[model samples]
Target: MASSLTKDSAAPGTPGSEKTFFGHPRGLATLFMTEMWERFSYYGMKALLPLYLVAPGGLHLNAATATAVYSVYVSLVYLLALPGGWFGDRVWGPRKTVAVAGTVIMLGHLTLALPSSGTFFAGLGLVAIGSGLLKANISTMVGHLYDGPDDPRRDGGFTVFYMGINLGAFAAPLVIGTIGETVDWHLGFALAALGMALGLGQFLIGSRNLAPRSTVVPTPLSAAERATTLRKALIWAGVAAVFYTVVGVSGSYTLNWLLVPLTLAGVVIPVMVLARMKRDKELDGTEQSKLSAYIWFFVAAAVFWMIYDQGGSTLSIFAEASAENSVLGWEFPVSWYQSVNPVLIMALAPVFAWFWLALNKRGNEPSTIVKFSSGLVLVGASFFVFLAPLSIAEGGHKAAAMWLVAIYFVQTVGELTLSPVGLSVTTKMAPAKYASQMMGVWFLAVTAGDATTGLLSIAGVDLNKMGIVALEAALAAVAGVAIYMYRNKVKSLMGDVH
Candidate 1:
């Protein structure tokens, strides 16, 4: 199945065409740089968020509360992608949706640069909502760059694009983390706003390189339909406004207040999407089967992210509190640890791309399920590796920085197997009319994982590293086994797809 997907993906294009940016469509370079800068802003803020929340001059929240807030923020960032995806598919298209979202995100960073707690929370909300608009659609646009499933460069293109993500992620912590940790948190956020400004500028300039198809609305509604949709949107917005007003007026606008609703949405949205898709008379049996397979893949991805995303929450705290910070002579900022995964990704992505290409040539690549299961196991093992140093340490001794680095290295390998492949597969499996919507549905897995991470944070799991590691390892093992056992059945459902 994997070989078949690869074969179709690698089909040759017109021989006489000129290669523009590393033998890819010229638009790829534009998307790559735009995504890089967006991530620079996103991750720059992300690297500092939890630390800032608990810092002496900032919120001064406890680690558990801080993690809870971080989790909810990150979860919403992905969850809101549902509406963003819908808007792109049905209304504005990816180009306009992304441009608008970028502007919102820049404002979000600027809001964070303010010192008031009210503005801080408001900033988080804006960033989360804006991220939903951009992340999935940008990825959707990346997939569209290829002519079809037959574009052999599809997976490779995504890998290169994934490198752009890592480039921004790699630089953010080093730049923002350093200033935020050493200088001032608000200054770090200001820098994040600056990053987004650069990205928005680049996007406006380079977006024209994209194929005209990228701007095609998949489902254009009639005037009456548009009116009804607008009415419903306004009603929802009014309700949300009232709720927020009440919370603000009551002085109850805390992370705990936000957590419950976001968690519920994480569970509810996927169910609603699945139900809607199942009932759609337009979809045939093959599409239904593929959608069913995608649900399981979604579950697998959620599990992987729940474990992986701890890097920003529990892991960051661990880096600050329990891990040795000194390297050679100078002490490093804890947020710098966030860069380790991206650094590894930048270094190793091309190798994984080549490895997959080689496997495809030999017709020996494992199925997507196998890769996902392996990724789960690798990430699971990372927790155990993280647990080891903590277990060995005695009398409140701090673990060496190398332990966290080792954990991130292992997790990055798992990410390489799962993340880019997941993106490619989602594009492959989605029904034509529901392309952007399905992409949004894919992000719901991250939403669920992130929400779960937040719940765990509120439960104070960070205080017990060994217990958390053990729990994660066990859960990952079970999920991996289940996926492995059902791999063949899922592949069969995928029909002609890998």
Candidate 2:
């Protein structure tokens, strides 16, 4: 398959080529499959994590503790991308970093396959590190595949790539979820390891699909810069080791306690990164203004993900404790619900373009920030869809499976509105040297969302689903309205990028 991907004499997207990957590039197929398998690895573990933490034959942690662990684990995965992106550019280059990260993810899944509480946390840590590395670098690599900001195929290409993400996610619960729930959790985790192993092999073979510049150092480190970076890295490593060692020896710190500092880091890091971007001399006034507009988009992305990403946590709990699991005489695992959003993504990816294309023909298409705001509002509305179910459950009736399906449907639409566009917009807005470039800033939005998600999941422990849902929904609505009102200003700030 790798050989076939590169076998075309004219190369993909060339004058004579027909855009071999669904009217795109053949290399897109290789990358598309690579991301697909990687997502299968990711979503496979995700489908199992929440349930395994609390179920029998699992870690058997209490609900609050399990939620804490889930929150921290997911939060740290994106949070670590800040450093992971740095390592990719300044150290190993994006291509090698992705390979290394994929290997770590495989090892992480294998670790989870071991049967012990200790191994569980260890596994999550390793997977988070690898995912952070892979995600930060890989999305930017996708951006590199296109000609530039003005390329018409760029957005569509990313949408295709994004489908690969959901395609893998769609298969996860059906494969890993069914097995994990009906069989051994360890075996399910082992399956995830196998998917990553396959992804690594495919990626290695299809390595040529990557753009030439994508493999080179975009910004090389000078001698003095290298020494300073090394010094900082060593100091941080030593400090982290000693701090964790002291806490470990004392046995006084709980996993929940770690969330405090993590929350702080999530809040601070984005600000610091944005400040670094503003201070960068390479960016012109127009780029800086574009970034200023991006700040609002970032807020929208964070809010949307804070609610949407909870599908694996809060929604999964609903599927377990409240949603009907038996249908037509067949019993299904709660994890089966995990596949809903991804399946919709696969279904909707094609329609998304045509929908916008029709609107563009009418000259009434919404701007990028407007689409982001719409996504935020819609995600919030998805949570609000749970309101009736919560009330119904209070009266002792389980929710119909379709209620969860409805929520997922709405959430998927909202995600499609923003997720793919965000990457392309970030790529267009960012300069080459502003601290991990576009991806770092883009993922910082996710870091902030996931950081707060852990704290928000605490609401689930007390069964305050209605209250939390209402508050979060209302906030998103307000934010969306504000962004819509300010759309013109944001567009102005964006200059010619949009």
Highest-lDDT candidate? 1
Residue 418 in model 1: lDDT? 88
lDDT of 2 by residue, 388-496 (tens): 7777787899888888888889999999898878977887887655534666778778878877776655444443368877888888878888989998898999888
Assess candidate 2 and give its lDDT.
Answer: 0.80
The C-alpha local distance difference test score for the whole of candidate 1 amounts to 0.83
TM-scores of all predicted structures: 0.88, 0.90
Residue 61 in model 1: lDDT: 93
**How high is the lDDT of residue 173 in model 2?**
85
Off by over 4 Å in 1: 1-19, 23-26, 140-157, 212-218, 244-254, 279-282, 360-363, 392-394, 431-436, 459-463, 495-498
> Candidate 2: TM-score?
0.90
lDDT of each: 0.83, 0.80
